[model samples]
Target: MTTQTPPVLALDVGGTKLAAGILTADDMLQQRAEVPTLAQEGSAEAILGRLIGLARDVIAAAPERPRAVGVASAGQIDPRQGDVVFATDNLPGWTGLALGRRLAEALDLPVFVENDVNAFALAEAQLGAGRGYHHQVLLAVGTGVGGGIVVDGKLYSGSMGRGGEIGHVCIVPGGRPCTCGQIGCLESYAGMRVMLPASGYPSLRALADDYLAGKSIPAVDEAAHWLGHGLAQAAHVLGPEVLLVGGSIGLLGERFLADVRLSYAVAAIKSYRNIPIVPTQLGADSGLLGAGVYARQRSGD
Candidate 1:
């Protein structure tokens, strides 16, 4: 007789929100709960307490108790130690946090932690858009742009787990300043924080809506163009089989993707120009699901 694997708890901590869910052995998510992060309003400890409370709420609604916990967080995470190596002001007081150890102790469960974008890439490669591909690149363009690289069907987290920081790649030398203390980085031009204000749209969704309605929004177009330029550079260095675009802005659908493709074609070398760029299949759940899957795989469960 075969024994069924137990469900695992998945947590995603972003600058704007905290989420928790129960992921079954079969990869289905249940009892999902979310709360605003309000990162700037309180100390990290208070935010952690809120996350812990969210986790407990989900666990209470789950059909079975989870055996382990996995966290996908916005930061440069040390996968080995499950701590934050670095973080931008988006997640205030997040750097150098011993996240895994704290969660493990609080819930009395083994825990694993990974950068949120890396987790998103893992989920896409394993079960979403990049499925069946051995190598791929994923770019997440939301509040801030981030990236993840998957080589040989596994996440290539680079030295100290800081690889795949494509958003920090310099696209325009001596241009706009970025949050990472760099000038002309892709995020400075393409991220929502910049695009939304520049486009005079109250939100990314509104900008996308206008673009989709045949309204020409110069800011959105400019962001897409720069994003494509960044992708082309990434492609030249890491010739992946495919590129997956995720996050809120990326999901602007075919119209925005067409613009990015046009820019990519112009910027990329001829040999690398044919690579397919597609939307992520899992939508908003990629990070949460990926964290759960990573925990299960790493724990040998």
Candidate 2:
């Protein structure tokens, strides 16, 4: 008789989209799917129902039943306790929700919940760009900027489970207001909400199209300057061995990268220099795969 190995179910709930996949013990995705998140629905139960339905669909498509589930959602997460302390504007009515217990009960298995960005970082650290490294930082610069830290090949959750809120770290104190109600956060400028217009295009994808058409936006370059400055500050604090740049905005052409690197260099203190900023290897599927891995690790399944 042959013993069958169980796959891990990975689910990622973002403000804009929902993605799920089945992951093998070797970190390979055996199946994947995605859907839009209609957050306007306005109720934790309703939204959770939608997410659960989508996850079930993905699970059904898997070649074999998964033994454990991992979920990645946008906003703050308390991984230690498995509670979603706050999901912010993306997921309304998510604060103080016992997400872990609810999902575990619903699925009849262990469920691990994590911040989407942090999960992205964890995936990259273990199976993607940061592989073989002991210390790394995963920075996803998209509609917002968030980071994940990996020390000694494990996630550094920090005190109070607020370790990776790099986007909230003040960069231009009292400059631009952020979604977190803070002023001059990195997300205010580097995030897609700001960079899209700054790139002189309607959106990040549009900017890519325009760049291909040889009509680059000067404002995009300016945004890159600010992004670089924020990254420099991050570099100063974490001193990570490698920085993986993920998210839709990172797809911006090398021109933007040049200015961002320049700004980072200029803003960085002398003590921290020469940190390599590279692109993500997992691409758009980072969050889903990360969720699977996180669940597998947390559940010991």
For model 1, the superposed segments whose C-alpha errors exceed 4 Å read none
- Scored by TM-score, the top model is 1
What tens-digit string does per-residue lDDT give for candidate 1 at 58-93? 888888899999899988999887999988777888
Report the error of model 1 at residue 204, Å. 1.9
TM-score of every candidate relative to the true structure: 0.93, 0.89
Task: Report how far off residue 58 is in candidate 1 (Å).
Answer: 3.2
> In angstroms, how far off is 125's CA in candidate 1?
1.5
* Model 2: per-residue Cα lDDT over 1-301, one tens digit each: 6675688899888777788889987668876777778778777787788778877887778788898899888878888767887777678788888888888888787788888888889899888888887888877887788889888776787764689778777878778898888899888877888767655566667778776576757766666777778777777777788877778866675666766778878888876668877778887788888888788778765
CA lDDT, every model vs. true structure: 0.90, 0.80
Root-mean-square deviation per candidate: 1.9, 2.5
Q: Which regions of candidate 2 deviate over 4 angstroms?
A: 1-5, 60-63, 198-200, 212-216
